[model samples]
Target: MEQEKMNLKLDMDVQKLETKKLRKGKHKAEEDLKSLKTDYKKLRLSMRTVGLGKTLEQWCQEIQEEKIKVGRWERKFQAAQMQNRSLENSLSESQNERDELKARVAELEKTVHQYRNRNSVVELKASFGRIEQMKRTVEELEMALQNCEAKIEYLEANDDHQSEQLHYFQDQVTKRDHIMGEAVV
Candidate 1:
């Protein structure tokens, strides 16, 4: 962006220099034409009285042609000045556009940064919720496993008590049979 501004300034400076050079050349041409006209009038008077084609006449004709060419250059210079003005206007417009684009880019960057910050916050919140939910589920599962283990312990104790009762009844029946056999003898 800085480079673009520098380039624009350089372009303006060069354009100004070109315009100044053209104006200076136009002024010089006008002065040369005035000088030529004065010399031509004097030379024509001398040629008329002397009755001869002098080197001065040829030089005067060349000066007249130079004056006509100078007029054309002056007109061309005016056209160039107009073009320079148009270019300056265009450059200014382009600079404005560049500034606006920079502002838009900055705004977009800010928006993206804000969105990322918000998204990260949301993700953290979701992760925390999930972790808390998992902790609760783990605790519930542990309690259920403890309850199942307690039931298994109770069932094992009941089975042992029932087996001991069955053994006691069998011993009593065997003793009664022995007593009855002795009485019969």
Candidate 2:
């Protein structure tokens, strides 16, 4: 009977030890699972951050490229403006020269009339030659004036076309800026 009691006690102690070991192993597994879950959450957050960073960098590069394009357009517009002003100045100078030539021709015509009434033969011949020369000069001046007028017209048309182009570019830039604003929002 005593031997039977000792064997029963030994079996009870083994069962207790096995139960404690199983509880410890279960606790360790739970801790390991919690740690793995925390690590996964951190990795997901880092991935999101990296994605956002790449998106921001791409946006910045696009903005910089847009700025460069705008700068080039502005420079072209300014150059066109300067060219228009120069053409205007040239047109003014040509008009002034035409007016002066017309005045001189009128004065020559009056002198020719006075010479025609004189009776000296040699003086009459000289006056006739001078009149012919003056007429040729007047014709040449008229032709030059006409050419200047045509050039002025061409320049004015060109300036109008350039102005239209500049407005179109400005509108495009404005639209791009609006789009970017919406995207950022």
Candidate 3:
């Protein structure tokens, strides 16, 4: 009877651990889904700016250009994120490492907060010079994203306009041909 009770207790402990892991997995999956949705929204919006009337080749070229531009910024963003993670992990490992990491984290956190909480461009300019650099980089990325979108829209709009013009000219040519045929007959 004593052994049976111990076995049941162990089984319950195993079940609890499994449940905890399952819950963690579910949470991570949800986070990934949300991140993917944001990325998809940005991607679809960027692609839609490209127009239908453009030749397949031109559309392809535009897509490649967009990809290159986005890829560069993404690499920079990813590198920053990775560095932050490494700092975090090092902080978690030992007392000495933790103190050094904590100080680094504190400095960065202060800088980020200062930049984020600034109410005016003037205040930001006076407070954090690196903040200006970060803002400039962000603005450049936003402009690149916008320009790529505009290029796609221009291609599509021009294609539609040209298509309508082509159809009109085609009708006129057909009408002239028919008239010539009738007159000749």
Query: Best lDDT goes to which candidate?
Result: 2
Top-down TM-score ranking: 2, 1, 3
- Candidate 2: clashing pairs of residues: none
lDDT of 1 by residue, 59-157 (tens): 587568756755665565555555555555555555565556556555655655665677877755655565556555545555554554555455445
Model 3: per-residue lDDT, tens digit, 1-185?
99999999999999999999999999999999999999998876665543233568975886687568556655654655565455444434444443554555567557667776765567556546654555555455555555555654565565566556656755865686566445644
Q: In model 2, what lDDT does residue 162 have?
A: 71
| Candidates in order: C-alpha RMSD to true structure | 57.0, 15.0, 32.8
Give all candidates' CA lDDT scores. Answer: 0.63, 0.76, 0.63
Model 1: which residue pairs collide?
none
Quantify how close model 2 is to the true structure by its C-alpha RMSD in Å.
15.0
Candidate 3: regions farther than 4 A off: 1-128
Per-residue CA lDDT of model 2 for 45-159, tens digit only, reads: 7765544434767879977987897787778767777776776777677678767767776776676677777656787677667767767776776777677677767767876
- lDDT score, candidate 2: 0.76
Winner by TM-score: 2
